[model samples]
Every structure is written in C-alpha cells, then in structure tokens.
Target: MNKLVTFIGNGNMALSIAKGLKNNYDIEVVGRNIEKLNKFEEELGVKVQKHLMDNFDISNKTIIFCVKPANVECVSERLEGKARVVFSVLAGTTIKKLRDNLNPEGVVRCMPNLAASVGESMTTLTGDEEYKKEAQELLGAIGPTRWLASEKELDIATALAGSGPAYLALIAEALADGAVKQGLKRDDAMAIMRGLFGGFGKLIQEIHPALLKDGVMSPGGTTAAGYGALEDGNVRSACIDAINKAYKKAVELS
Candidate 1:
C-alpha cells in the first residue's frame, strides 16, 4: 500500500509540502477551514479531510504538524497513539518536548524555508537514526533535505534557513531602493536588482563565497568602494546582530 502522508494544518507551509508531494505520494490535507481546504483540494487535485480540533485519527498515517509552536502540544495530545511518525515544522519545539507530548513512535523536527513553494528549499532534518530513512523519504519530496545529527543544530537552522528568506528579501528591497535613489525607475531598478542578486546566487553556488568576494574586490575599483562603505556602515555586525536576535526569539518561543 502507498504510504499515507497526512498534514495537520492547511497553512502555507502545509500547502507547499502537499503540492510538492502531489505526484509522489498519497497526500491528505486536514483542517477546520472546509472552504479553503476544498479549494486547495480542487487546485492541487489531492484529497481533503475535515479535521475538528477535538477529534481526528492520525495513527495510520505519517502526520506532518504544520500548526504554530504554541498549538502543537494541544494537537499532539489529540493525536496521541494514532500517528506513527510525527513530523513538525514548528520552530524551536524540541524533539524532547514533542516526544513527551505526542508519544509517537518517532518525532522528526524540520526547518524548511519559504522556497519550498518552488521546490528549492534548504531543509534541515533531525531525529532518531532508526526513523531517519522514513523521515528523509517524506521530506525529500519537498526539497533537498539534510540530516543534522545534533537536534540543537535545528535551532541554528531555524535562524538561518527559516528566517533567512526575510533577510534576503530585505536586502533585495534595499538594493532596489538604492537604485531608485540613484534616479532609476522603480520597475527597472527592481528588475536590475533581481538579475544582480540572481547572478550573485549563481556565483556563490559555483565558487566559494570568500573567493567570490575577493574576486569582486579588485584594487581601487567600484566594488571595493562599495565594500568599504558597507564595512564603514558595519553591515556585517548588523547582520550578526539580526541573526542573534532571531535565535534568541526562537529560544524564548520554544
């Protein structure tokens, strides 16, 4: 029989995974929003199951908990003894908490960024070795999955990948604004910024990040001037501070 993959929420992250797995597995999306769920079912051509907060059977399927961190314990309690493997995308909810709350055969914690919508997400997976194969099989359907032996690393991954996209978007927006400041049209500026960052991404993928920076920092060039300005503005320090703040918030929420 094909493995049944059941999603516990109909949020954006849940929708992304469901869409990604549409062709590879038997997927079901369960939630209280019947109208929205039905819409997604028709859009993705997948099964939609109604889920009430108080009653649901999760035992026979691999349950993906896509709810918020604060609501995970409540949902897990309702699914106790039903879900074989409980996979969670809730940030900062540790494996220990999940095990104690859900008491599933296995608990897998994952951090997948917004890029999952495009099947280009950088996802981090951490759980027991015995269940690693099954966890990988499920998450691999959404994007490239990497196993982190230490569960604590998921916290770092949360800050980096889970929250990284917003940081990149902020940079892109700032770049566009800078172009506008230089008297370019908004649409043209945004297009140019997109191409520049797209090429920068390709460069990082093809070469070492450090080497790419060195390559651009030619002696007495415009790139060097821009780099100098960034250093003067303490851009690196600001980025470090931002990540630190995000990590601290995750810890607090966990």
Candidate 2:
C-alpha cells in the first residue's frame, strides 16, 4: 500500500509538494482555506479535506507541518503520538526543537525552496538514521534530496538553496532595470537578462573560473571593463554580506 502524505497547510510550499507527489503517492491536504483546498483538489485531482485547527487524524500517515515557524510547535503538539512520521519545513526550527515538540520516532526536518514547483529544487533532508532513507525517498519525489550527516547544515542549506532563489531573482531584476535605464524596452531588457543568466550557468558548467575569466578578459576588453566595474562597486562583498545576514537571521529564528 502507498503511504499517505498529509500536508497541514495550503500554502505555496505545501502546494508544490502536493503537486510533486500527487501522481506517485496518495497525497492529501488538510487546511483552513476551503477555496484553496477545492482549487488544489480540482487542479491536482487529489483528496483535499477541510481541517479544523484542533481536529485532524495523523495516525499511520506522514504528517507534514507546512505551517509558519511560529505555528509549527502548535501543530506538532496536536499531531503528537498520532503521526508515523512528522516532517517539518519550517525554517529556523531545528531537529532538536522538532524532536522536543513532536516526540515522534520518525521526525525529519527538510528545507525545500520555491524551485520545487519546477522539479529543480535543491532540498536538504536530515533526521534519525531509521527515517533517513524514507525521508529521502519522500522528498526526492519533489526534487533532488541531499541527506546531511549533520543537522546543523540545514541552516546553511536554508541560507543557500532556501533563500537563494529570491537573491537570484533580485539580481535578475536589477540587471533588467539597468538595461532598461540604458534605453532598452522593459520586455527586451528582461529577455536579454534572462539569456545572460542562462549563459552564466552554462559557462560555469563548461569551464573553471580561472580559465573562463582569462578567456573573457582578452587583455583589456569590454568584459574586463565590466569585471573592473563590478569589483570597484564591491559587489562580492555585498553578496557575502547578504548571505551572512540571512544565515544570522536563521540562527535567530532557531
């Protein structure tokens, strides 16, 4: 028999997981929003039942707490001793915290980003040895799942893959804005910026940084001028600072 995966929220992450697992597993969503639940049911062709805050059946099911960090413990308490496996996607809530709250034999902490919607998410999974294999299989249904030996690495993964898409989107928007300021039409600027982003990914795939930079510099070419400007603007420092700030925030939440 297929394992039933029950999501406790109707939010984007929950929807993404449901979409990913709908075809392969028996997935059910229980949340407060009836309209959203109905829409998801119609779209995904799965069972979506309305769930009151205090009334939910979790026994024999993998209960996924997709609620906000503040509400994770509350939901966990309600599902305690009822779920076979309790998985949490709430950021800043560590495995220790989850274990303390849920007190389940199978408690897994996972961090999946927005890219899961496209099946390209970088998800990090960590938990007890007994559930590691099961957790990987469950999350792998959505995207690539890497099991970290140390649970603390989830914070770093959260900083990188969890919040990474927003940072990349901000970079894309800024690049497009710069192109627009240079007199390109908004659509045209976005098109070019999108291609440039793809090109950067390809370049990274094909060659090492030292060789790629040497090839691009070409003894004082336009590429060299652009690189010089980026260096002068302290762009590297800004990027590191952004990641550091996000990591600190994750620690604070934990």
Best by TM-score: 1
TM-score of each: 0.93, 0.90
lDDT of 1: 0.81
Query: After best superposition, candidate 2 residue 139: deviation in angstroms?
Result: 1.6
lDDT agreement with native, every candidate: 0.81, 0.80
By summed lDDT, the worst window of 10 consecutive residues in model 1 runs over: 46-55
What's the C-alpha lDDT at position 51 in model 1? 58
Q: Which stretches of candidate 1 lie over 4 Å from their true place?
A: none
Best by lDDT: 1
- Mind giving the per-residue lDDT tens digits that candidate 1 earns over 128-191? 7777888777778777888998766878778888899999999899879987998999999999
Candidate 2 weakest lDDT stretch, 10 residues: 48-57
